[model samples]
Target: MFSYCADPSVLDGWWWFSCFLTSATHLDFYRAFGAVIALLLVTAPAALAMGMAGAMMLRSQIRPLSMLGRFYVNIVRGVPDIVFFLFVPIALGQGIEYLLHLVNCPDWDQPVRQGNDFLVCRDAKMPPVDAPAWVRNLYAFAMAILAFALVFGAFVANTLHGAMQAVPHAQIETAESYGMTRKQAFRRIVLPQMWLVALPGLSNIWQILIKATPLLFLLGIQDVVYWARELGAQKTSLYSYPHPDWRMWYFSILLVFYLLLTWASERGFSWLTRRLSHGQATAEGERLRRATA
Candidate 1:
C-alpha cells in the first residue's frame, strides 16, 4: 500500500495504477495465491494416503472392509463432484458441532437444528464465534482440504486398485519362489510395479485437482477466484479507488496462472515417469534404454 493511495480521487494513469495494485485488497488477492498453493500442497498427499488405504481395503479378504472400500470408491463415481464438494464441508461441520453439542450442551433446551438454522451452543460452535479471523480461516481451509481429499481419494483408490491388480502374477510367484513371504513379496515386488503402472492415472488426478482449486470459493475460503471477482468488479465513485469493470483482466491473469501451473505439473509428471521407467523392464524402460544407448 502506498501513501499516494490516501487520496484515490486525484490519482490517475500509471501512478494511480501503481497505488491501485498495491492497495490492501490487492495484497489480499496476492496472498490468496499462496492459499491455493497451500491447499494443493496439503490436499494432494492427504488424498493419496486415503486412496491407498481405500485401495487396500478394496483388496481385503475381510468382507466388511472390502464392502467399506467399495462404498468409498463408488460414492465419488456415483455423486457428481460439485455436489460432493458442496455437501462435505457442511456435513462435516454439522457432524463435528453435533458431537460437540452432545458433550457441551446436553442440558440445553432447544433443538440443535431449529427449522432452517443450525443452532449450537456458543462453546460448541466450530472455532467459537469470538475466535480470531485467522483461526476461522484455518478451520474453513481444513474442511475444504478434507472435502477435496474425500472426493479425489475415491478416484485414486480405483486407480491404485487397478494398478495393483495389473502387477503380473508371475512376479509374485517368482518372489515366492525366492523364499519371500506374501507380505515381503508385496512390498518388494508388487508395490514398486504398482506405482509404475499407476503413474498415468495419478498424473491425471493431479491435473484435475489443480483445476478443482477454484471450488475453494464455494467452500467459503476467499480463494483466487473469489478475490478476482471482488477486485475486478466496477468500483463506483463512492469507493476509495474508482475503476471500470476489469474482471476480464483479472480472469485473464488467472487463466495464465492456471496454464503455467498445468504446464509445470505436466513437466514434473513426465520427469517422474521417466525416472520410474528408467530401470524397469517395461516397454517405456526399454525405449528409454534404447534412446540412451
Candidate 2:
C-alpha cells in the first residue's frame, strides 16, 4: 500500500480499494481458507482410520466386537449429523476437563455437577485458562476434526463393510484350500479388493465432505464461509471504505471454490479407480484387460 493509503478519507478509486482489501481483517479472511484446508487434510485420514476400525470390528468373528460395531455404525449413521456437530465437541471437551479435574483437584470439596453447570478447576480448561488465541483456536479445530471423524466414519464403515462382504466366498475358499487362515486370506486378498470396491462410495463421501467444510462456521471456526459473510456485509459511510453489500460476490467466489474442489476430487478418484482396477476381476478391470488385448 502507498503512503497515500494513510489518509483513506481523501483516497478514492484504486488507492482506496487497495488498502481496503489488504486490511488486517481481510488478511484474516484470506487465512480462513487455510483453516478449511487444514480441517480437510486432518479429518479425512482420521475418519478413514475410524472407519477401518469399525469395519474390522463389524467383520470380527467375536460376537461382542461385531455387535458393538453394528451398534456404532448403525447408531451414528441413524443420528442427524447436526446433532453430533452440536454435541460431540462440547461433550468431549467437558468429559476431558472432568477427568483432568478428578486427577488435579482430588482434595477439593466441590461437586463438579452442581445444578446444570459442569465446573472444573481453572487448570482443567482445554488449552489452559491463560492460553493465547492461536492455542485456543487450535484446540477448537482439533475438536471439530474429532466431531467430523465420528459422524463421517460411520458412513465409511458401512461402505467398507458392504464392500468386504461383497468379496466372493469362492476366493476365500480357494485361499483356505491353499492352507491360508481366514486372517491371512483377509489381509492378502479381501482388504485390497475392499478398497477397490469401496472406492466409489468413498469418493462420494469425499465430495460430501468437501461441501460440508462450510459447516465449520457452525462449529465457531472462522472458516471461509464465515469470513465471506463477515467481510462481504455492508460497510456504511461511518467506515473508512464504504461499500454496498458484496455478499453475493463473496458467496459467488465460494461457489467457484467448491465447484473446483468437486471437479478435482472427481478427477483424482477416477484416476485412483483406474489405477486400482488393473489386473483385477472387477468389471472395470476386466474392461481394461479386454482393451489391452
Candidate 3:
C-alpha cells in the first residue's frame, strides 16, 4: 500500500513486508475471514429453524407427519456429511432450475437430459448468463447455505427430538390436568425445559458446524481456506509481490482462527446454559438457585 511498494523487488525488510501484506490478494484473503463468519451467522439460525421444524414433525400426532419426520432424520443422518455437502447444492440447484424450466420453458420440446448434459432454456438460467460475478457468487452462497441447513438440520432434529422426549411426562400431564391443550403445554412448558437438555448437543453441533466452514471451498465459495491456499502459494519472478512457499504460515493462521472461534463458542454456550438452567430442577439449576440465595 505504501508508495515505496511501487517496486516491491527493490524494497526490503519492513517496507516490502508491509506492501506484501497489504497487497490486493492479501486484502481479499482478509475479507474471506469475514465471509466465514458471515456464513456461520447466517447458517446457524437457519439450520436451527429447519431442525426445530423437523423435530416438531417427528413429534406430530399425525401419523404421516411423524413418519415424514422420521424419514428425514434417518435418511440425512444415515448419509455421510461430506456426501450431503457435495450432493445437496447440485440437487437443490437442479431442482430449482427444473421447476423454473417447467414454468418458463413450457413450450421447449427437447429433453432436459441429453446424454450427460442437463439443458434448460435461456430464460431458465438461475441468474441469467449475463449476470455479474457477484450475483453468481451470491447464488452459489445461497445454495451452500441451503446444503448446510439441510445436513445440520438433521443433527439438530435428532437432538431436539430427544430433548423434547426427555421432558418429564408428568409435567405435560400436570399441564393437561389444568386444561391446557397439548400444543399449549408444549409451547409454554415443555419447550423451555427442553432447551436445558438440548443445549449440550446443540453446542457440539455448533462446533462441528464451525469446522465444516472450510467445506465452503468445495462449494466454490472462495472462503477462508481458498484464500489461504491461494495467497500462500509460491509466486514467480513475473509477479509483483513474489514470495516463497508460505502456505504453512497461512494455514497456521487458519488453525488459530478456528481455535479462537471454538473457544469463544464454548464460552458463549456456557453462559447460555447457565441462563437456561436458572430456577430449574436440574443440578446446575439448583446450584444456580443456591448461589443466588
The most accurate candidate by lDDT is 3
Better of 1 and 3 by lDDT: 3
Q: What is candidate 3's lDDT per residue for 25-84, written digit by digit as tens?
A: 888999999999999999999999999999999999999999999999999999889999
TM-score per candidate: 0.95, 0.94, 0.97
Candidate 1, 71-128: lDDT as tens digits: 9899787978999999999999999998999999889999877899999898899989
Pairs that clash in candidate 2: none
Q: How big is the positional error of residue 273 in model 1, measured in Å on the Cα after superposition?
A: 1.0
Top-TM-score structure, candidate number:
3
- Give candidate 3 regions above 4 Å deviation: none
Q: Summing lDDT over every window of 10 consecutive residues in candidate 3, give the lowest-scoring window.
A: 235-244
Q: 258 in model 2: Cα distance from truth in Å?
A: 1.1
